[model samples]
Target: MQDMIFDNNQVLAVGSEPFLSRFDLNGKILSRMPCAPQSAFSVSLHPSGVTAIGGYGGLVDVISQVRSHYCTFRCSRT
Candidate 1:
């Protein structure tokens, strides 16, 4: 799951699957992505309307407020 700060009201949760999941303004799930398996982990949201998602083996994906995307260095410990 990915945590997103939308419209400054509450947090929005989007699934890690390739498809998109829908949620109401009240943070209720109106719909969900079709059952697709994807490797995803914890999610953190910033006040700047950015989202950070950690994936398996410690890969981090970042989504910017401008709708751009980036990936950060991965760190892991066994």
Candidate 2:
């Protein structure tokens, strides 16, 4: 897994296909979801029940209430 965050007695991890997953303390996967096309590198939870996954190519996936939205940014190298 590339990144993980613990909340509400569950573990949220981001990685390969099924990029975002939630696991119980016993390591059983409770739920899984796709994030970005590229590998996810970070995961964060919001107080408002929103989830954000950051990945390559300046892509970020935001999930709220079972709905997903992708945001992108352009980066320039000097």
Candidate 3:
């Protein structure tokens, strides 16, 4: 079994075989994803401008980070 989502809170469910169905806003099965294949276990959305995401494969995905451009001076013997 797999979980599917149509609108913000609405959800459409199906088995592993894969099929087609439609529904309305009241927890009804509307359309399907682009491929209409397997369903994702979980999904999330992140805002733009400096963000991070982690995966099961020990991978840390990042968008941006703070940077410094200051210079340092060094003294030498005469």
How would you encode candidate 1's per-residue C-alpha lDDT over 1-78 as one tens digit per residue? Answer: 654434454444545664224466766775443222254545566888676666555666676665456545477786
TM, every model: 0.53, 0.79, 0.26
**Candidate 2 weakest lDDT stretch, 10 residues:** 67-76
Better of 2 and 3 by lDDT: 2
Q: List the residue pairs that clash in candidate 1.
A: none
Q: Candidate 1, which ten residues in sequence have the lowest lDDT sum?
A: 31-40
Question: What is the per-residue lDDT of model 3 for residues 1-78, given as tens digits with 9 covering 90 to 100?
Answer: 343434335543343433323357674555533212332232222343232322223333333323111222222346
Clashes of each: 0, 0, 2
lDDT of 3 at 9: 57
Superposed Cα RMSD, model 2: 2.5
lDDT of 2: 0.77
**Candidate lDDT values, in order:** 0.53, 0.77, 0.34
Q: Considering lDDT, where higher is better, how would the candidates rank from best to worst?
A: 2, 1, 3
Steric clash count of candidate 2: 0
